[model samples]
Target chain A: MRKTLLAAALVATSFGAQASAPGGSGCGWGNMLFEGSNGMPMHLLATLVNGTSGNRTFGITSGTNGCDTSGALSYNGENMLAQAGVMEEVAQDMAMGDGEALTALSVSMGIPAEERAHFKKTMHENFNTIFPSEDVTAEEVMGNIQTVMNKDKQLASLS
Target chain B: MKSINLALILVLASAPLWARATNEELAEHPRWKALLHINEGTTWRYQGRSYIDDPEFFLHESGATDARAELEASIEQLRPAESEARCDFPARYRFLSQQLDWPDDGALSHCSDYQEWREAMPEERVALIFPASYLNSPSSMFGHTLLRIDRGNDEDGVWLSRAINFGATVQGQENSILYIYRGLFGGYPGYFSNVPYMNKIRDYAHLENRDMWEYQLNLTQGEREWLLAHLWELEDIEFDYLFLDENCSFRLLELIHLARPDSTLMDDFRFAEVPANTVRSLDRAGFIESVDYRPSKANELDALVDRLSASEQDLALALARDASVAEEEAFQALAPRSRNLVARAAYAHLRLQNREGERSQEVAQRGLALLRVVNRTPTVPDIDPQRPVSPEKGHGTKMLAAGGGMLGDRGFGELQARFSYHDWLDNPEGYLNGAAIEAFNARIRRTEGDDLTLEQLDVVNIKSLAPRNRFRKPVSWFVNGGLDRRFIGSKRHLTRHVQGGPGLAWEMGPVIPYAYAMARAENNSAHDVLVSTAAGARAGVLWYAESFQLGLEAEGLYYHNDDRRYRPSATLNVPVGRNHALRARIERDGGPDRAETEFHLSWRYYFD
Candidate 1:
């Protein structure tokens, strides 16, 4: 398929240069050659082969393309907040104490999966400060999050 | 050039080429051919000789004859930093550079203008938005979808973000039926357009009284960048619009496919796309990170009204209707939250009902005082509801039914099937309970003699019965045009049917009920194909729990020259599993000449 070729050529050309930064050496560029980008042909073919199995391709294709998971964070200030809308919802979730926004917020805060229970409690307790009744703006929330992030060792490095 | 050479070798190795290929032919080279669907003149083979509608988007120096030249011209514009670039070129450049392995030109310096706009914006977030069905409108039955490009603002931006909507660019004078027919049959040009989220909020929430659901997407910035740029490529390009397979929902699925090429979101939807089902595909792909519910103004008003005691509601109603209620003891005795809640409801009710100017200045002034008192308590009444179940958890659109039954005196085996959508009489869990959009449903039965006959068929049947509460008084409506066999004149009759109109519907705490006034037409085979037109009224009720659904429908019509009749039907359904159900239906359609009764039952299966 065209996308596979393009991905191949892209890897051929950008591999050496990308290895140093966000495109970690062990990441997906090498895998794309074997799997061929999940191009339209393979996608269609997989659908035909799977035939009503329910959730056929995502289990295999997800995070396999080096872009979604196990991918190094971008240094371009295009952090999770800039790239995906999750962090925005995450802020609201911290206030609500639950939902997709919370999951996104947790990931953005770099909290380990196991520690999220305590992290969630901390978030719930700090909801008032995060969304203070006083002067609140984007800067204030960011500053508040920064303060919270610094207090926790894991999130401290991110701050 | 090396990449081009590699592409050239690949193309040559794969297939023989015409000697001295035309520029058009060169555009069909493997590398270029893959993108041909995005080009103007490229043939899509099966979509009925359709061509992209915008010529300027495809024009090259050679009078648009050379697609390769046009692509090069287009790519040249993408080579600059976004701010320096013209026409949001980064959208194009980002995609091409990533996929084509174009050489990186160092870190992109922020396009000052774009950066400034972004800085003023919230974080970048994408949500696949669905405005639940509003029955009075046929086009909204399967519901409609748009992408909300949330600028990462909190709750506020979900209502203020940019929305990408793909819809037909109809000019004028076309009636609803004409519009529906053309929309389903590719008789219009579809365009992708953007507008502020507030505009959509006003349209879907305030004006339409439809609640919206926003499913959060967890796409990375790279994916978002590709999506944004692909939208740029499609900015001016137009595709022939066909509601069945290439409507708003289908186009949105294509956008997602472009973003996450690894996912096949458009497969089951190749023939027809249900907006809700398309969303379900996104969820299945594991792309949906979360869901957010946006209550319409009416929903808010209803929630507020519910909090008030009936007497308080009456006081608020009086205050909203006239300016003399501030002195009433009932109004004066309420607590701040209750006063604020009632005042807010009253004000919203007046505006929503389009009677804002009727509330006197005295009333308005009193309402404002109550609002000011209400605001003193923390924040504006925040009653954001918990997210609803995702539609994917609902029964699949396509269904198959098989069982044995009796018609008249003979025993029979039957099989029935339906395409696209849901019906209130079907499983009600995980779907808009009262909304149904079914098309091309057909049933066939074989009697003891093994004689096959068409029992009944519906060409298209769409219904939206969003229940109006005291806060929201939405009009319910339906349109069904198809063939059906009913007992008329003491015998079975198959007639061509067409009917639609407006009605009132409400969720009366325990049950959802609706009524309609419709104009109907039918071609009766029993009457030698004589066309019959009539004005009719219908009423129905639907009672549903997670595993059970029951519905009753009754209708009466007066035909031309005083012919009159009434038809009533009842149905009950029990969901068998995620993909199966059992249903029983009974009906008695009475006419001036005759009244006939029938009962039927079947077990159903579903496919995605």
Candidate 2:
């Protein structure tokens, strides 16, 4: 079973296929949010060898954020977090109220430098709302973040 | 009409001679050789082969072994105005077009795919990224190096940058033993991959808990573009991956050398290429414009814990264990700032604990509860981890030593050499603390009236003594296998042995103490059995200071053959400079039948 999964993964890597959301738009930001928890053993093996077991990416789909073309969260028509696969870091940084990952996220979201502190504080206060369940998908988190920002008086304008 | 035909014939006949002279001259150029991946050799025929393993990388039938033939074939293949071969090998086209003064009538300028890739990667600068060594992992013991393509605009930070990495593309599921064997013997096909910088940060800093050093290079804009075009040419090209010399570091140096042909970065390394040694080469070649440090999540957590008081630390631990502690008065009694620190520590601790584990709902809820407390309280200042000395400042990897000492009653002179890596007694400036990894180390001794003989040859020795603290519990372990000269009854004979085990270590002030339960299997000429196995225990204490290091160790082994042996040793090492040190050792080996005392002092010199 593991070998079959690895073969599938190798195919995906060769074709540069994105891990798109299930039953959703082709935004590619759905189930991969919680992927950090799975694949522990394989991940360790890859780390041990200093090699990627078919986890290669070319940054072509990564730097272009997401497929949300009509949203304020999209910066320069790109969704930075869509292919980031950094939901774990984003969650931890949100809890800490500030971190490199969180700061980078905000910067890519078109949040100005002066208003980043308010953005962090608001995210810190609503951490549970954004990440209500352990199995929360990245799509749900993105929606929750948009909802939270829409309600905040200071950050509402930016959202 | 006849006169015009004769003129055309004369022009065509003369054009062949002129172009042939230029083609021959260009084929022999140094840049062409670099592009073909040719090595310096004694003769032209011997030096013509390229290091690239894949046959598809060459345009000619015998291009892998014949550079001149490959050049001619490439020129012939690229003569058409609109050919797909130009897209496949854009860098070659660029080089040839300039050399041959090709017409600018759009003959060789059509590479839409290459142009799109170039536009996708807006790289104006390049940096060498070195993820520091993680002792727990075998392949990363010497660390790994990759290249980062940075844009001139610093709006997105480096998280959005692209990284060029070269590594073995492992196929199927292989066991650890097979993996190591194949990795060292070039059984795997290696490829160059481009990935987002954030993915690597997630892998190294967060997942593996290893810090990273970035050495920004000083290449011009044109050079950067040249390197990028070359990277595109190797999109799916395969190179045989050998873990030692022809590995990631070696390939990266090749790319950098191709960019700046005058730099001598690839001159010193031929046999083995340690990543740190490559960084040193870059520095020596003046390719480094600046250095940056990125601390790992573990390092950040340590720095955070360092700022907390003892009581606060207990409170944080309690909060991490039970979320209800946040509602109790024990947590509420502290100042708001203190509460923030405690809550932050709790969340960080829980996250780190779950780094390698499956996420649990209970732990996630508890983490959220701690974050609630942090959000309610005043925000505390951020913690910045203190940076250690850069890796280039460390001592060289190869070591050579000469000394004289006493073996039992005879005076002996000894010489020792190691092919690569650090030992426990060496300087600890840019290496992992309390870790020793050595390979291919040998020591030879000459007694007063005896011939020179090898005293010991350690094929591979690795020891990681992670001192446990309140926040982390790491297993200290060691494995050593090699041949040693041992006294069997009355004669000395070379014996083969392997010994290792797991143990515990503790950090106290400036000293770290550790103990291990060891098991050994040995083959000796003096033993009655074919192989004698032993179970034993070893304990040691190491004291580290600014200028010197001291270690005291003792071990006892009981063989299945009814033989018992005990050894107690002490060693002192004083580092004189970055590449020089003095070391002295004294040991007493005793058994039920015989006892011997030996001492040695040596001056060590290190080089790449």
The candidate that wins on DockQ is 2
- As for candidate 1, its clashing pairs are A85-B125, B91-B229, B122-B151, B123-B151, B123-B152
Predicted candidate 1 versus true structure: per-residue lDDT over B241-325, tens digit per residue? 6655566776776677667666655334255566767777788888999887776666667776777787777877776676346
Q: Count the backbone clashes (under 3 Å) in each candidate.
A: 5, 3
TM-score for chain B considered on its own, for each of the candidates? 0.79, 0.92
Cα error of candidate 2 at position B569, Å: 0.8
Model 1 interface RMSD over true interface Cα atoms: 20.7
Tell me, by TM-score, which candidate is best.
2
Candidate 2: which docking quality band? incorrect
Q: Can you give the lDDT of residue B545 in candidate 2?
A: 83
For model 2, state the Cα shift of residue A31 in Å: 23
Give residue B328's error in model 1 in angstroms: 2.0
**Model 1 chain B worst lDDT run, 10 consecutive residues:** B41-50
- The count of residue-pair clashes in candidate 1 stands at 5
